[model samples]
Target: MNLSVVIPAYRSERWVGRAIRSALAEGVADRNVIVVEDGVLDGTAQVVQATGARLTSLQRNGGAPHARNLGLAQVDTDYVMFLDADDYVENGLLAGLVGALERERADVAIGPWVYDGDGRERGMLRQPPALDNAERIFHWVMHAFFPPCCIAWRADAIRAIGGWDERLRKDQDGELVIRALIRDLKVAVSEQGNGVYWQHDSPHRVTKAQIKDVMYAADVVFAQLEGWVRSRIANGSAGDERVSLGRFCCKTAWVAYAYGDSAAGAKWSAKARELGFHNRGYNYRSALLASVLGIRISSRIKASTRLVYRRIAQR
Candidate 1:
């Protein structure tokens, strides 16, 4: 099967070249590796030209989601994967994922992945198991714990969902997955190959965005999900959409706390409680701790402990 890789690059001259090479090294034709330069016009385009990969440039600076949608519009292959300019695929990874999609007749195929940050391998990350049931799929999409590189999509399936949500500056991948699963798209897992998500402390990293802006973008995403889920319920869908949204709020509270925005964290924690989501262990822990020491103090303690744990894990 013919597969294409669409990499969205924005001021990523330092890493785009290597990302393109990794995709090309997957035995894909150089022309099949498309990089959409997101209007930065930095050395990123020149690097793409040097690698002899197909290059598409936006006239204005759009975020990765826009760049990815533009790149997707140009793909004519049977399958395509949207890879971040800073991340790359393992040899044969793309082909293996495509094979799984074909074998299982699935709309999307997700593969295993590992963390590569600070020039060190952080071991294999957890892979989602079979998404054979709607409940499992909903939970996975809601969490959106995996990066985009771990997934390959049938071009039409993504188009069916109207591509990525350009309104989001972060968590677009997870939001897209939520849309896809809600539409009842078939998903499968590929255990044969893996991708590497390049993590770093770069200020340009989307994850490093200002906390308030991040919260706004996240609110947009969850609001979109809420509208879709409410519609699903009106149509007699099986899942309790509020429960999923509650969990999402709980997770977003964690993000708020991670960035030292205890106010936003408290807001999200309250939203979760308002949704009647007191049973989950995640919500229970945060609510119990916040009620005692207050959100500010409790969040600081949790964030500090998580930072130490993450540092230890990276070692």
Candidate 2:
């Protein structure tokens, strides 16, 4: 099968070369490596040219969603994978994902990934066995287990889904996966750890430091999922819909709290509770704090705690 690897790059001069080299080393003559340079002032363009990859340069920075969409427009391959410029994949990533897709007759296949951050390897990001359907895949995605680099999509399937949402600056990967699952697309999971997600303390990484933007993105995703759940219930496919929505609310609440958005945390947690989701562990703590201290005060507490933790880590 022909595969196209698209790398969305923005100010990624430090790692773009490595990313391009890794994609080239996949050893598929039919494979195409397209790098979308999202208005980089750095030497990212030079690096892409050096590697002889097809380069699409945007006049201004438009985020990963826009860059990926631009890259998708140029794709003529049977399968496509979006690899971030700062990330790399194992040698057999494309072959393994394509093999799984063919064997399982799946429209999309996901492999395991490793997290490399702070000059060290964090660990492997592995999914549970046999996530073979829409509901299970949505559940895993809501919990943030799915990353874009580890996923390969049938070109036709992605085109049918209308590609990525260019409006979202964060959580676009999750949004795309949610859309796929809502369409009841077949998903296959592979055990091979072939994707590497490089996380560094770079201020240029927009998503890493934008807590408010993250919360807004979460709101967008939850709204989309809510609409999908309603449609599913209307169509009599309401299996685990309530539970899944509640779980998603709970997860989003904790993330909001962690990100110093106590108001959103409280709102989502209250919704989860209204849906019969019980408080448990750290979630209970977040819900209680949001309820008792109110949004402004609870947010202050969270921010202060985060500052203290960062200071301690710096020492």
Candidate 3:
């Protein structure tokens, strides 16, 4: 097979048909577009079957990482790309991605991602066509390299690095891409890609713990990163930059709020003061959280805090 498009679907009967049709319309001859149905109640497997794409239903919903891993095991193609069942590619996606990979002779090819809702593009994360491994890492600092639907990668590169970390609730894509980069995997960015990432996530989505902290992946990743920092301090790990500890108390505070532990959130926000992250964004979020909880902090105190936030914003 020339290319494999792996779509891990769960409860996506409403959109799976369109997603499969989009891939078939792309006209990649001998292409394998495999949709793994993860215990979907909405007949998502039947939808893919009707679209003429092969379907493999999982016994249960095993999260994104598990579905991707299953897809990887099944693909026989030289190159592979992941696509969520709810998202579809716009016109010219197949030609752009496949051609870009062939021309660049890269181990992995990525492209720009556009967030769409009800047939309208709302947000786009654009990327340069060509980049080195180091540049790819920095580029990822801004946005994810693989939009799941935007990457065409050599099968060997994925297998060698052992694929993704299934343990993470979110940011599994980033972790996989980072592992590929750290191993010096050759990669390229597509010149054009109209892949649409449908926005179905809400303010309170499921997290690693499946409770609060819908965006809890960052904090867990941070803890792991701290370990890297410590090992490096002891002069361990020859390569790998010591896990970048720029003091993200701002992010820590948000993580706290997401986990539904207001006290923990407040503690992190207060610590942000000591860490010099007493900024407008974090402060505003803190106040919002405080407001929702009906905290006893009065209006005058809120005003003072807001002023302090503005001062930090200036910096």
Candidate 4:
């Protein structure tokens, strides 16, 4: 196998097969598609088999990276990439990505990632401000860097870094790439275009449920990322790690509140407030970031925040 394309399937029965087929069919190269079902409620394994793609099953749900590494370790592909079971790849995506990797002889190949709904583009995960001739991947972590799905990596390079850490539920991709950069790995960027990242938004669109879960994950991830920043500062890298850590803290704060953990979330909100992130609607993102920093939103501030809250209550 020259390429291993791993899809971590979790409750993705609606389109797990489609995601697999897209990997096998539209990819520009000969790569094996492995769909790892994480103890799903639906017949996700059956769906993978039905598509004639290889299937791997875990006895329980262990999040994305865990499912990915199971399939990843079994293959001998020269390169590896990941895709969420719910996401579908686009035409020319695989070929364009592979060509760039080969041309640059890069340990990893990256590109712009556009976020989309089932049929339309919703947003995009921006490439870093820059990937300088001499760059620091750790500095430009994309929520979690080198988006796992939008990237392809030399298999040996994957091993050299010991593969994805199964511990991370949210920012594993970013964590992995930064580790690679610390080892001074060479990464390539493609000029083909942004690869589509299909986001399965809620039909309700603005329910408490939708935003709540998002906050839960963000809260957890930011805590881990803070530790990562501290370790970096200890190593004497660049300016203050506080700036980055503070930014993540504020973002996690609002999500924590959205997810119904207002008490826990309030802590993040207050920390963000203390950090001086007081921009209006931007405060929504701020509230969540503050939550991660672990401080409480004063009852007085919470009461005041309610007046503006009604204007956007439905969403």
TM-score of 2: 0.85
Per-residue C-alpha lDDT of model 3 across residues 259-294, encoded as one tens digit per residue: 465666666566556544445233455457555643
Question: In terms of TM-score, how similar is model 3 to the real structure?
Answer: 0.71
Highest lDDT among the candidates is held by which one? Answer: 1
- For each of the candidates, the C-alpha root-mean-square deviation to the true structure, in angstroms, is 2.8, 3.3, 7.4, 6.4
Sort order, TM-score high to low: 1, 2, 3, 4
Model 4 agreement with the true structure over 255-275: per-residue lDDT tens digits: 455445677666765665665
Model 2 stretches with alpha carbons more than 4 Å out: 125-128, 142-144, 278-315
lDDT tens readout by residue for model 2, 1-315: 478888999999899888878767875442389999999678899988888889988889988888998999889988889989888887587788888888888888988787765555467566545754655655565544667768999988998998998877777887788778778888887776578888777787855747677777777777877888788789997787776777777777766776767788888878777766765313456558867875456656776887786555544
- The global C-alpha lDDT for each of the candidates, from Candidate 1 onward, is 0.80, 0.77, 0.64, 0.63
Clashing pairs in 3: 213-258
Compared with the true structure, the alpha-carbon lDDT of candidate 4 equals 0.63
Off by over 4 Å in 3: 29-31, 119-125, 128-131, 142-146, 201-216, 223-244, 247-249, 258-315
- Model 4 spans > 4 angstroms off: 27-31, 119-129, 133-146, 201-237, 240-242, 257-315
